[model samples]
Target: MFKISRRKSVNLSIAVALSFIAVVAVIAVLIPFAWENTPYFSKLVNDVVINESQQLGRCVFFVWLYICFAIVEACCVMVFVLLIRVRKGLVFSEISVDCLRYISWLCMLLSLFLFVGEIFHPLMFVMAMAVVFLGLCLRVTKNVIELATSIKQEHDFTI
Candidate 1:
């Protein structure tokens, strides 16, 4: 009969969330370094692309890729905020639903960008599919949160 407290569970989740944010931030910063090692990734930002137009395209591609990373960073922050709401016993609230919706939208937007990036790198297509899946999951979760929030509101009003 051993059960961990809610606060402890939330704390552990927050720690994991923070770790994800840190790891993603580090990887985003080091993305340029990783590009050189992969064949598909090396097309942009390398001497292999000798034309001026190609250099510009590579720069833009990398910038967009960095922006995708930033989107992921934002999602992690949203998850952290949502976990805090759970810790405060506000999981079935409008704010939590809103946070989840924002995350879902961000995931969708990131996936759109990644799909376009498939032209430059094949990995982009794979990442796009994964992000779309994540987005769909988030959307479903947001819908559940919205329903719970409405039911909670109704119960509060009845009381």
Candidate 2:
């Protein structure tokens, strides 16, 4: 395999990554609103029951925590994308690759938490979402690898 330059790979990864950030950000903002406004989601949220007020608070806290985590993960991706867009000459391919993997793992963990923590089966729904997010991350990783290899080959030919 031809060696690929980190810069080109990173640039492509960042471009693709920005879309992920936008999607995650939209979800992060919209989910709460949807839960509040949409009749179906509102019903689900309102229907959840816990033994005590403290437990109810805990449920809300957990939901908030999950959303916060998603926001943070998306922000990390966005920050890297911003860096890639502004900088030149050098590449941060490894960082981009790692971020995709880490974010996917985070989604998996959050899904597991929801699956186990929530009394209702709504956690299953969250888990399904996590699967989709993870799949997107995998696609990104594949694209990055392909871009890296292509860049490396191009640079080698130019040498």
Q: After superposition, how far is residue 108 of candidate 2 from its true place, in Å?
A: 3.8
User: What ranges in model 1 sit over 4 Å off?
Assistant: 1-6, 32-54
lDDT of 1 by residue, 69-158 (tens): 889899999999999999889899889999999999999999999997776666789989999999999999999889988998999999
The prediction achieving the highest TM-score against the true structure is 1
Residues 52-137 of candidate 2: C-alpha lDDT, one tens digit per residue: 46446446754755665664566466456545633653343555555455655655665555555455445666665766576577
Clashes of each: 0, 2
TM-score for each prediction?
Answer: 0.82, 0.45
- Estimate every model's Cα lDDT from 0 to 1: 0.86, 0.59
- In terms of lDDT, the poorest run of 10 residues in model 2 is 85-94
